[model samples]
Target chain A: EAGVTQFPSHSVIEKGQTVTLRCDPISGHDNLYWYRRVMGKEIKFLLHFVKESKQDESGMPNNRFLAERTGGTYSTLKVQPAELEDSGVYFCASSQDKQGRGNTIYFGEGSWLTVV
Target chain B: AQSVTQLDSQVPVFEEAPVELRCNYSSSVSVYLFWYVQYPNQGLQLLLKYLSGSTLVKGINGFEAEFNKSQTSFHLRKPSVHISDTAEYFCAVSENPSGTYKYIFGTGTRLKVLA
Candidate 1:
């Protein structure tokens, strides 16, 4: 079984440019989450998806940031007009479900975004 | 609201020496504790978790953490560490209420094992 996979492991864009990061969760996983770690900062939660529906999105930084999970299988986070502060490592994680004992969340090699 | 604090930003120890990384958390409700390790250019991997049962939780790579409810701490320790153990370790907590599974992570501790 493969672990969570992410695309564009590293990306560099100018300020005001747009970027999209993608994540494919493990097979049969129903819970997907997004988090990020800025330079010199702790990893912070961005949002979560339970299947196609968003379970929580309180951590989204601003209106320029948007996340979507289509068909409950994969997710994408888009940053419109990316700013210098948007530079960081974006991580995607998945779990079997919300409950149970063995439901440990697995993470992917994060996408490194650098907005100059 | 839940929060985590990793007391040390970095810890340096000689190879084959014991090491400890301190972590503390605050939560109003029952919570699940976890430790994760991130190698250079790699994703975070589970070290161990404390859902219930014993306070002493052992994890992969010969690491262990003690959960102290009275002190609100889960400090990770290793009797003897190798240079391969150098990595960033994170302490995380999630409220178990209805299994929301939303994690709150600490700043992380970078363990540098010297040869």
Candidate 2:
């Protein structure tokens, strides 16, 4: 099976600019998640999408960030008017279902966004 | 809500030597724990996990973790380290079962194995 894949592995933009990260999950997976890791920090959860509907987005940093899963095939995370604090490596993950106890969530290589 | 703590930010060990990476978690309710390894410029891969039953879980690449409920710790250990083992290891915790797969990750421990 193909693992999670992301586009534009690395990006650089100035402050107040906008950037969008894309994640294509593994085939047949229904659960998608977004995570970010700032400098010298742990990986923090951003949100989750079960199919096309967002199941949980409590981890979103602020309103400047938005996530969409159009048609439930792939997902996009957009950060508008980006700040320097928004610079980090964004990771995307996906799982098959929620029935099994030890379900595995595969992750992508991550997109590194640098806001100057 | 839950939190994971990786006490050691970095550890260096020689090949054929035993190594241990410490991890502790805090949570009011029951939780599922996991250990993920990430190579340089790569994604995170599941190393091992502790759900129930066996407190000692053996993962891929000759790595194992022992879950201590009393101490709320899941320490990863390797009897003999290898140069290939150099990577960043992250400990994570998730509440609920498979339905709520949201994970809280630790600061991560960077393990460097020397020849």
Instruction: Give the candidate number with the greatest lDDT.
Output: 1
Model 1: colliding residue pairs: none
Worst window of 10 by summed lDDT in candidate 2 chain A: A96-105
Model 1: per-residue lDDT, tens digit, B44-108?
99999999889999999999999999999999999999999999999999887645578899999
TM-score to native of every candidate shown: 0.98, 0.97
lDDT of 1 by residue, A24-96 (tens): 9999999999999998789999999999999999899999999999899999999998999999999999998
Q: Which regions of candidate 1 are displaced past 4 Å?
A: none
Span of ten consecutive residues with least summed lDDT in model 2 chain B: B93-102
Q: What DockQ, on C-alphas, does every prediction get?
A: 0.76, 0.86
**B1-115: candidate 2 lDDT, tens digit per residue:** 5889999999999999999999999998888899999999999999999888999999999999999989999999999999999999999998755366999999999999999
Q: State residue A26's C-alpha deviation in candidate 1, in Å.
A: 0.5
